[model samples]
Target: MRSSNYDKFPFVPVAAQADACQVGWAAIAGVLQAALAAQPAASGQPVVLAVECYPGTGLRQLRQALTQALQPARCLVAGDLYRPTADIDAMVAGPLTDDPVFGRLNGLTISDFFDAEKLRAAQAELAAAAGELVLVLGTGATLVCPDATVVVYADLARWEIQLRQRRGEIANLGSDNMAEKASLKYKRAFFVDWRAADRLKKQVLPRADYLLDTNDPTAPKLISGADLRAGLAAAVRRPFRVVPFFDPGVWGGQWMREKFDLPDGPANYAWGFDCVPEENSLLLGFGEARVEIPSINLVFAHPRELLGEAVHGRFGTEFPIRFDFLDTVGGGNLSLQVHPLTEYAFDKFGLAYTQDESYYMLDAEPGASVYLGLKEDVDFPAMVADLQLAQADSTAPFPAAKYVNEFPARKHDHFLIPAGTIHCSGANAMVLEISATPYIFTFKLWDWDRLGLDGRPRPIHLAHGAANIQPGRTTAWVEQQLVNQIQPVASGEGWREERTGLHEREFIETRRHWFTGLVPHHTNGGVQVLNLVQGAEAIVESPSGDFEPYVVHYAETFIVPAGVGAYTIRPHGPALGTECATMKAYVRT
Candidate 1:
């Protein structure tokens, strides 16, 4: 999750009393009620919103406090973060999900929230609702609007409950307010003078902390859907969002449109939290730090947190390339995230140019669609002309649809989006992005016909975006086997790619899968990225082996190691999986 050190807005301490808290709170609540009533309405009273624990932690407390503050001034509805799972749809009629508020909170669980288009529609519908303020514990999705917002955060007690992440994170935020004065820029400077803990401090170097030091190898993989859903049910009792930094440049900073009262704020730095984003923090790569996990092979991992100098060494010119996924709440469609021309982005934004990206279906439902590349017979000049026309006239229809390939995708399907390819992961679907780092230059050719709740037609940048599209490309193949195949690999063992240059970069390689009864995976000498595409299976001899089968999700991924040596996967439930690929990429830079 993106760490926040900024002070909570509009809430003054008791010492300051009713003055700071009452004025803005009252007026804001009234304005929100008026906005919700003006937008859309549901059959249920003021839309239903629920949370897990009302006052479990600072995050929960903040949410409950926000909800209460708003309700006295308006009639919006809310409940605890957790309300058990409900079959309310069958219980209620008139389109059971007619409430826009529920749309905001849909993806909190497995439901159809992951379906991009449906998600967009639901969000749009809720936009018309009375607004909402809700939070789902454990997950990191937070929805804030003129009406209300639902927040999900990690309880200070748990370590890995939250899913959202910023590239490199360090320091800690507990009950004490040390984080109140923290900043990403400070970490940059501090990492320079940093030192590691005398002992495991060396393990914090790179892959060591994430891969090696975690635990034993040889673990089971098969996980039931029921178990997958409740994997951390007991571990995550309370979740909270803590934005300690006030720098607006962060992705969430801008999407949420938060403005703090601190000086030298905007000029500092942000996590690049936009839907499609780039993280260029000066501290990301200082030098190179490598690791050798006890059960995993040697690895040079990405240092997401600037723990100190030893970590800084991991980032340097030799290892300059990077990759990550930026998930934004509202920005309409993304900035048609294709790579920029030449070093245009580097020259302009100083952000690297590693935009050659592809989409790995993570979570989606029936008819979940994705708009990628241009269809055949479309003239570049004509397409550009159409884009310009739409953006110029307020009432003009978007001309982008006529030129792209549309697909209603299912989980695990891959769409390769080379650099300069025009595409969007779409509104509703949750996607796993495999791309070169430097997610900075996205040229937005068009955004479907929609407007933010603020009565503003979201901004479009055709001229800027059009400069990046490599015309004549389609959402088509890279290479596919006439009839695909799978082969199991054992740890301490690796299969060779005859074509070495296939993926040549800081982190590059192709993927193939192996699954057989009692299959053996030997990670002979390196760390690998294993993305489960089909059936639920477990890894043998794994640090997390003592636990129950992880029942792999169709698209969820886990990092493995050669040191773990020859683990096994046992399929549970139905027939073992469908075929998929896993990347055992190495850092060539």
Candidate 2:
């Protein structure tokens, strides 16, 4: 019902002037041409330009643009050096397994994709092109010409890659399956393509001459690699936000579409990825131009500073905490599901940890409810049989209400869901999902007999869900352990803090603050993610003026890196004198 103040493209201002970034093909090409001209061919050999791209980056468009501008004597697509698509399909079949939604993590690198003979031949071809400009480009261009005169690393965000996959505009690396189902393509990218591509990107980004932002194929942006690094370094020193993306789902709702002022296209918006670094983008501002890069790059490049010593030591370069929105307002119920326990996750999926989560109800309708745990004294075997029968027959919907405990949900109610607990949020509720960031391991047991947007039955992993479901998590246990486990922790003159769980078994801890005045906060040597759950606007300020005051709007999530040390928040703008609330999550340690 409120006007949308949600910022769609949040960027960290990196430079005082705009000259560091070049926008559009003409501007970007001009910068590259100047760099090429400055560094002439050595020993009368060709000036080799290497455009190493992240998979799903539009290489064809990049080649055409740069070719027209630079007039390269020869341009080699890295795919030509790759083994046949059939061979790659066979090579990845084991890791990609036949699963529609899950796969083993691939250990392959970009080098493994190339044919040894073809690579050597390409090397020779580049060497023989004396006195002529040669361009080698694709996902493994740097590997093809390691000693190139200039290197451009084209980077695209994971969400953008997924959109491209959904549109059938791109395919996984070293494969010719552009027409594959988006979900299957996403599985391949998650388990195979991205893993291999990330290995190469880590090596190339730190030393590449330029960083290309290719999220928008029509208008690419270019910045020096040094500027990109500087932007990342600047980010960790302050409270910043990753660019959030919204996606529709089978049980999506209209809350976000109306509240976020999203265009009317998708039927509804289900997810708002507010702080998922692995799947979000971060924009770096250079005066007039903004360059988009995968938010994970910041986590990779500055884990110690951004995550703090303790968190970095535990998670390495990974950002373990995630904050996202799940809106089912004016929609249908979420699928009944369970996440794997830690041991099972590692044994089966190579995950070091599991997805232990908590759902904080941000808004709810009069009868909003959440399905959690199980019904007391329910027939366990009969429930499983019912689930199996439902899976087997489309017309028979699993009787969820008969076996699951439905708890009334209200605004600010936090429900703890440790791994192995059966749970789902009922429709007409907006949820702020805070969790450990192994997000894709969900095992759905039922989907209300609904078909997906692609007009096919959604995949159900009854065996996986049943194996992980804890039968002992019944009504009484859930009442005592999960529902609204809130305890008053501390208070100030105009503010009070309460510990809103995450069960003891979970690594993440959450807290809620109700304030009408300044509320002091510290990272305590670990990264903290927070959202202004109940306010029109609030200003986050550094106690020592280390960083500028950052303004966050209602339902907007932001991160305070451990490096930020101390900060304070207070209602600002329209919420200046009104009581406001914030929910914060961090690693338990």
Candidate 3:
């Protein structure tokens, strides 16, 4: 495995001396016991404690631990108090709907899945009890347990949850059975619950008095209120980096293995969410205990500091920029897809903005290409018919080149793809996809008639994609607007700056640089994401001498906080006059 530099970053915490999963059950129990003891029953009233966590948190094991730790307390399993499973089925039993850009399915809010009134009444009854009462429930309980004396939020890394789910340890919202399906109706319900969980985590985590990182059920890590507050405050004050999440896909590639120093697995590393806080996990180590929470929790806690005053004002708590990898080297092509427009995305998906992305080619084998836009004078209806027919039969080959435009991609080549534009990255290419933070709005129209890794046909949004596609984005128009538009803007001793405004919608702006010595750069009151595209490594420092310099490796992505207005990039081991290339993206002013 490649050496982990995660500890060197300011945001990522060092590993605890405890187990690999960073669980400390003894410490957790001690903290809970102290809290229970501190809040003695007053005037014959009970002390109610609620442990709110997500699904698949090893509740059975946690219940045993909490019972042993909090002796003489009445432990109430929240599952028994949950509303009937019939209610969850009824809420999502509706048929799947589709918009102009994608299929739609609404997830149950806390109210839809659980009985709020019953939970509130139960907590109220428990609060009135003469003895201690503990309620172990999912995150929704935090909002309902207003009468509880203590509330704690339990969190697990998403990858851990997926692993448990695959092992048949966790089930659907109300059933012990996995709701695995390739159909849109089933997937939409899944998306709804997933999105709702994220929403709850974003809103509830900061208010939590104690945060539990239950990555390992046996030894959950606990973070006190003071330590949690301090860690969050420190992150907002400077440029922050979180631990990236990696996953394998059917069209997964091999470049990530060596480039990212990932360990060998059964399948190749397809995607790396380098800077996508939405799905990534953040580690917070306090002394010997390490806690991990969803990275988006940090953004929700300090939107202004992390996203800047202007950015926070416009986008609210949403992180405006994201950097991820789409490695197709030694793999197959990505699905031909488009994203919803700004308005469409908000109406159908509850996202503030649509996904306007660009593919910054990190490396590409000879003859590799990207399918972009549409061919001129295309028969739109006929093309739609062909795609529909292809989706019906797995053996039918998709005539991608017949409808969509194809462009040759080379190393460092950047291709702009605004929403409503059909696009896909071809094989033998490593693409660093930089875009708005809304990463899940992809409206796939075709996938080369291939099944997903699950051995099921991938769902295609043909009607939605057809309705939203920009037919005006013809091959010729894209040649001028989307293709490489590199223009030299500045130069110094051995360095020069070039503007590459690949974001056609101007949601964000990107620039590439060739530098050896110190090249001055500024955040300009907005967060900036930089990637060392060409050289082996470089260091980013504040010219004002405010913070410690950050060393970044090749193909490694890092952020420059809005607070650090001015900084410099100095390439390592570069000969004088030799250029080291780096790409930077920031919200457009």
Candidate that scores best on lDDT: 2
Q: Model 3: which residue pairs collide?
A: 23-219, 24-219
Output the better candidate (1/3) by TM-score.
3
The lDDT of each candidate is: 0.34, 0.92, 0.74
lDDT of 2 at 480: 99
For candidate 3, write residues 45-95 as lDDT tens digits.
Answer: 777677877766777777777777676456665666667877766555552
Model 1 / residue 243 / CA error / Å: 16
What TM-score does each of the candidates earn?
Answer: 0.41, 0.98, 0.90
lDDT of 2 by residue, 373-475 (tens): 9989988899999999999987888989899999999999999999999999999999999999987999999999899888888899999899999999999
Model 3 C-alpha lDDT versus the unseen true structure: 0.74
Which segments of candidate 1 are over 4 A away from where they belong? Answer: 1-337, 363-366, 426-430, 453-459, 474-507, 514-527, 540-555, 561-589
C-alpha positional error of residue 1 in candidate 2 after TM-score superposition, expressed in Å: 9.4
